[model samples]
Target: MPSSDDEATADSQHSTPPKKKRKVEDPKDFPSELLSFLSHAVFSNRTLACFAIYTTKEKAALLYKKIMEKYSVTFISRHNSYNHN
Candidate 1:
């Protein structure tokens, strides 16, 4: 009779191999006008996680409006109020 350790090894050898993760493809045709508004951007894989824009308050508001109209997004802002000075 096989020992418990031997049986465990046999079971592991018979188990199916792990599946490979599929690569996420970035968008092929992004809007040019929106691209002009961004000063900096960061993407993780195919997802845009952060971006920045330098412009007048009015222009910033307009950009925000345009983005809201074009995409479904949940905006998150972070602030650190503690000063270490």
Candidate 2:
């Protein structure tokens, strides 16, 4: 015969369900507010670094396109044509 403690353990185990893990987002995956702040800080110093700036939505789209194009290799280029005198 099972003891009272064994019975309690069995009941508890059956009452609770396993928890599902949540997916985490990567920092470099897209343009977050932090990215914007960094962009502002760095580009503010030199206008040339602000040649191309992408919004969060634009960054998401770019990420999707990059994924669909091919996962073999990915290359991101940063070009700044601004001339601050």
Candidate 3:
């Protein structure tokens, strides 16, 4: 029979791969869909663990602004009277 350490090594080699976590940032530092998803998750009142040390709130807000402009669906539409005309 193989040694206990050998069996352990074989087991480790056959172990399932770790789950991939979602990435929020990109190389260009531009706002991506993942970031937008996380921002929307805030509305769900769910606990979220974010590791966005490099990204700032301003960037996320800018992303949301871009999204709103593209889709014309504003979550806070009261102040955006420009759409009225």
Checking candidate 1 for backbone clashes, the offending pairs are none
* Higher-ranked by TM-score: 2 or 3: 3
How would the candidate models be sorted by lDDT, starting from the highest? 1, 3, 2
List pairs with backbone clashes in candidate 3: none
TM-score of 2: 0.26
Residues 1-85, candidate 3, lDDT per residue (tens digit)?
A: 8999999999999999999998855446434543654543344666444423233545667765665676544243212212221
Off by over 4 Å in 3: 24-85
Model 3, position 46, has a per-residue lDDT of 63
Query: Per TM-score, what order, best first?
Result: 1, 3, 2
The stretch of ten residues in a row with the least summed lDDT in candidate 2 is: 46-55
**Alpha-carbon local distance difference test for all models:** 0.61, 0.52, 0.53
Model 3 worst lDDT run, 10 consecutive residues: 76-85
Candidate 3 TM-score versus the reference: 0.28
Which lDDT value does model 1 have at 71? Answer: 68
Best by lDDT: 1
lDDT of 2 by residue, 1-85 (tens): 9999999999998896878988855445443433555533333444342223343554756765665575443444543323422
TM-score of 1: 0.38
